[model samples]
Target: MERYVLTVTLNAAVDVAYTVPGFSPGGIHVAAAVRRVAGGKGNNVARVLARLGVRVAATGFAGGAAGRFIQDELRRAGVVPEYVEVAGESRTCYAFTDPETGVVTELRERGPELGPEDVARFKARYDRLLAGAELVTISGSVPPGVEPEIYRYLIERARSCQVRVVLDSSGQPLREALVARPYVVKPNRAELAGWAGRPLETEADVLEAARRMRTAGPEWVLVSLGADGALLVGPDGAGAWRAVPPQVAALNPVGSGDSAVAGLACGLVRGLGPEELLRQAVACGTANARTAGVADVDPAEVERLARRVRVEPV
Candidate 1:
């Protein structure tokens, strides 16, 4: 009776975040503070779920000492891992935040090299984990040479095992996963734009693009537009964007979407209706934006924002 959700991360990493005073390239400066956290799209989603009191089993590939640090960090955050060990060192993704300008610059690595045997082993572990999972969430980037259809592969397997699949990925993986069609897929602004082959400059554009993404494969789509809010499009057909409101005092935009995805998964687990889920998702996102470097979303804020989350027709 292990009731848990599985979060799969293919391009997992150790996230290092630091803030410095006003910064300019080649300027001598003193570092303000630095923190390292276990990170990956799926891992972050798991963290949000755990913070919300949901049981999660994170499954992903990890390598070397850095990978071990990632696993240890997840444990501290109450997210137990079912990690598959690999040969190379895990990659590190850094965030350089400047308080003066209120800007964050991201430097991402291509991630460690994953071999075919390593891939097979990861799949085997995934299959084992899926047997006991209520929901399977595939998130983050699919590394080079790992077929874009990997998302499709996982979704198909999850379907075969009668578990609902939740996907949060972008680029070709998003395109490929559409064929197998997971239960839920969350895409952000730029990601949705690429799927539509046009920029989503307006709310109407986001709604249309979400539907287009739906046609590609996922049963339900939640399109996220930072600061502005998020939209839900599905068989539930509840399309609405919860505006952040003009004067909410927004902060870091990072991890908000992942928090929203975690909210949707939690909602699905609770069998909530479309409107309730949408509101909760927005609450989680808005709360995350208010948090500093860490992705720990304030539960109290989610509740407060949930009441004001505006959902309008597309």
Candidate 2:
């Protein structure tokens, strides 16, 4: 039987993007174009997975009008919405982009706090979804009042069902979840550096840090390096590979990381080899950077870029 990939976003939002000619702090600026959509790391991942023709379902805490908008938008984009409702309203986020500089500044609101009752409800729903999930990608920040241990609990639950899990998070949450030993942990260079509590200055430093992280729990540590592509370190820290992406002038990079997560999930479901998986992951990230909207990737563009991705074992 074919299984689907399930994506979880604890703190969801309605994302509004505005494009401006240029930005100046403390100066009035007008938007040239505006677009609004449902957003959260897992939600974006689910959207990209759907675009790639993967079977995907998005779940998490959602409430109020903003939550309804998120559900409608995800349905419109062909992603299955399986969110658990709460009492408080969902959050909103705004991204301001400067066309000339390709710089984006984000203004985000903290989502509603989750009560004990809310947590129990979500956990029940999540348990039901795990039965049909072959792979699970848990991404983004937890809402207020939610403990960092939430990731650990979810990871353990997925593992109990023999489901592979890809975790994308940072700070205390990432630190806590590492104990659960996720199947894969996807973090960017910056997040890795933060986890290390020191700046990673050289390639060797990055590789060493990833190796050390692998010792903690994750089977695979995939570190994203933006335009430079990504680095992958295997379970034993002996197998390592680097994937170089195709060059493209990026317009907006809001959801590129989440796009990469989707690509990784796709590769896993398709049973692709390590090298091929890294290549596809980088290609998807590159494709997302080529577009202005979050998770708005072109499948043809991804294929074109995939051909140019260079994957080499390190």
Candidate 3:
């Protein structure tokens, strides 16, 4: 039996995207097109991994009509859904895109609050799902009433099951989960700066911060720099590589980080080397940026971008 990669999104949402001729805040603008899809960081990652031909299962707390839409869309995208039902309606996120200027503005909702019963139920479901999972990726923020330590508990559980865990989160949850030592961690420049409690002003500063983080837990740390590309560091600072992606006109940068996380997770599961992994990760992110919508990347585009990516060891 093929072992599936499990993705966890504690706060799931229905993502609605609208394309307009141009965006003018506080002014009326007619939309050229509208689309709705399943969204959440992990859900986006699962979609990209599925596109890369990996078997994936997405699990999290969801409810109401929006939740149903999320599950249906995940199924349509070839990602198996195994969500736990909650009492409240799931949240909705709105993304407004300007095709002319390639600017996207998003209005995201804080998810519904979860109670003790909701947390307990989701934990029970997650434990059972771990039985068949080879790797687990936990992403996004936890809803209200959930402790920041929730990720720590889940990381410990995944370790007990002998499954690799990849974490992509920030702030308090990230601070707590670092103690559990996940296999990999993906944080953008801003997040890393927040964790370090100081602005990372240079490439050297970012690399140093990534090295400091590696000592706290995760075997690998990947720091994304948006158009500037990303920097990767391995366990104990034994290896380091930086990948600069090819410049392309970006359509929607909303879920590009999730796409990068998907690529890094894919490379890890396939046992790709550090350089190769960074290449693939950058390629996927670039492909995502070059296209519209979340995880709507083209495979051939990814392959072509991969060759154009410039990776250098630090």
Q: Give lDDT tens digits, candidate 3, residues 66-130.
A: 99999999999999999998888899999999989888889999888889998999999999999
Q: List the residue pairs that clash in candidate 1.
A: 178-217, 234-237
On residues 189-233, what C-alpha lDDT tens digit does candidate 2 reach at each position?
999999999999988999999999989999999999999899999
Each prediction's whole-model lDDT (CA): 0.83, 0.94, 0.92
Candidate number with greatest TM-score: 2
Residue 8 alpha-carbon offset, candidate 3, angstroms: 0.4
TM-score of every model versus the real structure: 0.95, 0.98, 0.97
lDDT for predicted candidate 1 compared with the true structure: 0.83
Please report the TM-score between candidate 2 and the true structure.
0.98
Q: Please give the clash total of every predicted structure, in order.
A: 2, 0, 0
List the lowest-lDDT window of 10 residues for candidate 2: 230-239
Best by lDDT: 2
Summing lDDT over every window of 10 consecutive residues in candidate 3, give the lowest-scoring window.
290-299
